[model samples]
Target: MFPYAAELIAYAAGAALLTAVGGRGLLLISGLGVAATLGVVGPLLARALRGAAAAPQPAPALT
Candidate 1:
């Protein structure tokens, strides 16, 4: 939910800036979008992977 909010804010801000500045703002908006996405996704991915690694595995079946 927080990540989604961050994404929404970033997109809204980027869109606003792009609309106001046209082509010149694109690079900045693109950089911001990437940074925001990474900021949100990196931690989520790390946490998910950590959780998965920590979860218990099932025992193997007998041959």
Candidate 2:
């Protein structure tokens, strides 16, 4: 399951990069790919960062 998800992410990233590199003519597909990649990754990164930030800080030991 994780492998498949990673593959999908790879595919999207590749598509976005390809579109960015030399696909100015195909604006529609390139634009869509970029949007799709952002849509998928943006929220996941945000959630991960938020979770990291929300992790409980260790309490100081009283002397």
Candidate 3:
């Protein structure tokens, strides 16, 4: 999946979850959403950072 898409999904999911949980204020909900988003996206980001940092390969020559 696309990295940015995954991050967006995570954030939306968090906000929805918080909404269901019934927070007292928008600030609190927003804060929790951020934490939740980070929790999910953090691993994906870490994995990418740990992976190879190689440059993109060039296209193959025509036969």
Candidate 4:
């Protein structure tokens, strides 16, 4: 779960910054790694974070 929204957003900003003033080739490789990492982790992170901000649920009484 992304408890810290600012921290989560910083990565994207940093990547954009890196791409903005960098040369080709190496930057492309770094970009691919970053994208690949995100592709792999993003969905799992979303699943784990699905109920992170939801209200607590009550348990049903067993008869």
Give one digit per residue, the lDDT tens place, for model 1 in 1-63: 999999999899878878888876788777888999999999999999999999999999999
RMSD of each: 6.2, 7.4, 8.6, 9.2
Query: Candidate 2 regions off by >4 Å?
Result: 1-25, 59-63
Models ranked on TM-score: 1, 2, 4, 3
Better of 1 and 2 by TM-score: 1
lDDT score for residue 41 of model 2: 100
Candidate 2 vs candidate 4, TM-score winner: 2
**RMSD in Å for candidate 3, one decimal?**
8.6
In model 4, where do residues sit more than 4 Å from their true spots?
1-23, 51-63
Overall lDDT per candidate, in order of appearance:
0.91, 0.85, 0.81, 0.78
Give the top-scoring candidate (TM-score). Answer: 1
Please tell me which predicted candidate would have the highest lDDT against the true structure.
1
Q: Candidate 2 residues 12-53, lDDT tens each?
A: 976876777655645666688899999999999999999999
Clashes per candidate (backbone, < 3 Å):
0, 0, 0, 0
Select the stronger candidate by lDDT from 1 and 4.
1
lDDT of 4 by residue, 9-37 (tens): 97777677667766675577678989999
Q: Give the 10-residue window scoring lowest on summed lDDT in candidate 2.
A: 21-30
The true-versus-predicted C-alpha distance at residue 2 of model 1, in Å, is 27
